[model samples]
Target: MSSPPIITSSSFSSSNPFSSLPEDVIRAHIFPRLDGCSLASVGCVTPELHSLSSDHQLWSHICHSKWPSTTTSTLTHLISSFKGGSRSFFSLSTLPPNHNIPSPSPSLSALPDQIISAVDIFYRGKCIFSKVQATETVSGWFKCSPFRIDLVGPKEAVPTPISRPSHEDTCQNLYADLELSWIVVDPTGHKAVNVSSLLPVSVERHWLSGEVHILYATVVCGHVTCSVEVTCVGGGPGGLVLHVTEACLKMEDIDGAHLNGRDSLVVLQRVLEGKRGNLCSENRKMGKVEEGRKKYLEFLERRKERREKILRREGRLDNLCVMIGSFLFVGLFYLLCFY
Candidate 1:
């Protein structure tokens, strides 16, 4: 009688459990279970998975899941133009922003006439508000005037089921409840980037109207940075009805000077082109919102230091000018007295 051959676990079942399963099963069942980062890691396991993970459909679904506003037909069409479709987009928008930007010179070559902003506001991991707004850049008004994108129109109250907190805890309440995603898509450039910190950078109460202003800021590329503000007002209990009284994004310099549309768009395009933070390792740990803000905070500190240096330089120049004028006046006075 021949000895029964031992059946090792590895021999009985292929080392790669997925190898035995049909590709369709893996694509339809397994890949969908993973996120963009996890799916990307699985792709590295074998050539087969790399192919399966590259499926545009899977990435498209992931994109739609994270950003509800990406489902819009206009934005969908724009996403399709990306080199690898939604996969390319996920890569750009998922990584922490790359603060390094090239020359701020305006370029109309690849600049789109309009941009689509896909915004989602989440509270405690559940989406409470989602909207898509289109901002037209072709207007002369846009170019000459300040660069701003208003998602919520005046007199428009976007109701949410969140309770208005007591005046004292309002700031903390808003900070704890809200996390935002603001993805900007460019059709002509075929680029997309999330220009938000995923958390409110600042929350302040208006001393006059009792309104709360929540600000989310990010460094666009170079000296130019962008910030989005969502203003929320009080609603009677159950009227816990939340309204986005104002949801506006404005781009400005470190010195608080607003950039014109052309210049703002140029810096924005540089962001789409340069994302040095894409080094998100496989099995990617998407950074914590607090950690994501490190670069932003550092940028702010850098700006502060720069401003102080400028002020010091100007002070020295002023003192030198004063001394030169005083010396000349005194010399003339002595000459007249002697004469």
Candidate 2:
């Protein structure tokens, strides 16, 4: 029996199939599959790849994928402000602000109407949920707090402690009515559950910077609850950054007794206590530790001032309450005697 000779096209048989394809084909077929990190690495390989990677359309997709809540107008404005266009903007958005890379300083005019907070929630050290949310200030008792808790969930009608703003106010400050939601995905069933209704238990301001820590806890499914604590920092001309400091999964048996919950709690405690790496190494490199110490002293002074203000306000409120009680007692005695 005779067999036909093996044949393979030289163009298709090459190890790098991307090189074989036309630039248009590569742009259309391959680039979309790459994320911002992958695109950056691939672009460095060759000038041709670099040119292909620099396309505005490619970077636009990457940016939108990373920050879906960003409006078209906002993206256009950001792209225009960056000298390197969308590619540069995407790189800046993904990379943590380090001294080595200059942070993008968009003019005030270019600031987006609504600031976007992109969050990635991890479970068991794996990314289970990621979403871009528009932050809104907490209202009522929490409004004046230095730290604000931004809530994000699935539905548009998620209840808020603060009343929705008036039309005029919302129009004037687009950031006022921005929606925040949290999308929690179950790793076991691979199903996504929106815990938008769950409110943060606490929001604390870090002393070092204007950063905030938000804690959220909710049950994703039966007998299982997940707790997520993230710190939002690094917002200026550059967008907001969220660092997931803690993610915990608690499980219970059918009888509602804790099952291995202590183990997970211990693991979470260890993780929280572990030392974190400094993102801004430039300060240390530039010998700015003295300047940082001064800043810390200023922070302490501010804390002292804030504490004094709070105590004075408390004193006033206590006096007002005592006066009100005394007046009520006098009125009651006079009424009884005269009657």
Candidate 3:
């Protein structure tokens, strides 16, 4: 130190080392700030860049950037949708009838939970698929997929959707045979819904832009439906759940279908029952939650406790207010502070 005349690196290293770095280098530092979808996109820019992004470090960084405040499940679902994975099954759309129905005394808004429960009961296990096709002379047709989702309310059902192992080498084809959908239930009820029917998907590259897009065709109810362009997205560990927030079903398409609203609800109820039966059978095989009867009972107990706790908390707050008022009354009348 004496010989070097007290040279200090911290005091004088002010030159912008990174400022002069190449654009790619700058991008490396900047890109980690982006979410998974954007980061995946960045990797496709070039072969060299793709190699750099292949590092697990980059993926972890991108995953963390996925959503700042969302739950891991919520973020996973969002990412899955972005990646063109299974569409969420549970969607919450208000039944704004295409034609005016009688306005109820309390109005539909006042009893949303009832409306939702009724709808859920009606369509729980019945899949409603729509066909969307793009036409040269008219709006394209969109074919909807149909697969019923078993409802366990807000609780995660014992057997998860991810349990099935894949034997196929290709990830795309692995899930191609099975339809996937999602249902998201927040404390207030429904959030977002997605429904995806599986079909063979082929992605094509834009020669000029280098971007990727998907094309697929599948037989939807005996009709050969096709789409030239579709978003490519994937799901995460906790299977995505979606609920339609605002939806109006046009009853015009119900001409040939034997399933009426009540019948649909009955079908849903039976499907749920069948699922419970299957789960029970599977549990017997796995020795977990046998019959699900006990599990259902336990769920009810937990729900009761939660309601009680909420009521007790509200009561405590009210009592505290009363006690505070009583103390203030005595203080103001009797000069308690001086005493």
Candidate 4:
């Protein structure tokens, strides 16, 4: 302990350089440089350090910097390989439920809940409609004619309500011409023949009182002809009362094929007939009132004109009488002087 190990302030200062440096310089310079260098050596490091390589946000930035056009699925796959944890934590493979992207499977009956349920039906992402058949219960085999379709429903699906049919006892109106054009992509590369002003089949909804229902458009595949029939079961304004039916191309036909999983087209029709009826009724009542007001105004105008004319005529008659009386007085004075 001869020289006390030559204790010097310079050595202490060198050893504790970070203690004297500013916070920003330490974070900006030292941390990033250290982190970057550490990240570069991450793959060769221990298991704990390798797990940090799975930080998707950090890798996502790197990935975007490298392959800017990488798709979600690709990035997800790459991240999954680096990640040691379970797959559920960072799912790059699946899209958000709100994207409304259709799945390849048919077992999932309804669309994602986030999609605007009552969207104007689109076919293969096109907003136009073409001839095809849809059914309420899609069972085995059914036949349908070409037609346009539309819906008069809520912005979202609601439970079907039970109620008696507003009309008579037995008959039902199933479907109607939506007056919309149905466009189909020729997957077979055959040019689709354009039909000008084809008559649309009038379809109606069959509301079964106390039931939940939905409306869907058709996505055509292959060389199948389709048509839709709407059945209004028996529901009033407060029920889900519409039904759809579907028909497909025959099983053994590839000449015009039925492309599997073609989604339905959803068309937004004009205002509901019930609302339209109410509007018409209100318009008729308003028309009658307006007509009555016009008639009353005209009557008042005519009465005022008649009164003014009568007053004018009376004033003219009074002036004529005064002139006559003055002349008659002059004549009397002249006759009396001649006598």
Q: What's model 1's overall lDDT?
A: 0.76
Candidate 4, residues 1-339: lDDT per residue as tens digits? 121122123422536553466645533443333222234344234343344444544545443332222224533343345333212111221111111122233232322211111112222223222223222323222113222233333332222222333534322221121222222212111111111111222223334442222221221222122332222333335443432223112111113233222132111110000011111222443353344334334444555676788889999999999999999999999999998
Supply the TM-score for candidate 1. 0.82
- State, as a TM-score between 0 and 1, how close model 4 is to the true structure: 0.18
Q: Candidate 1 lDDT, tens digit per residue, 118-162?
A: 888988878878888888887899888999888888878777666
The per-model lDDT (C-alpha) reads 0.76, 0.42, 0.30, 0.30
TM-score of every candidate: 0.82, 0.34, 0.21, 0.18
- List per-candidate RMSD values in Å: 6.4, 20.7, 25.2, 28.2
Query: Cα deviation of 26 in candidate 3 (Å)?
Result: 5.5
Better of 2 and 3 by lDDT: 2
lDDT order of candidates, best first? 1, 2, 3, 4
Ordered list by TM-score, greatest first: 1, 2, 3, 4
**Top-TM-score candidate index:** 1
Give the count of colliding residue pairs in each prediction: 1, 6, 54, 55
> lDDT of candidate 2 vs native?
0.42
Per-residue lDDT of 268 in model 2: 22
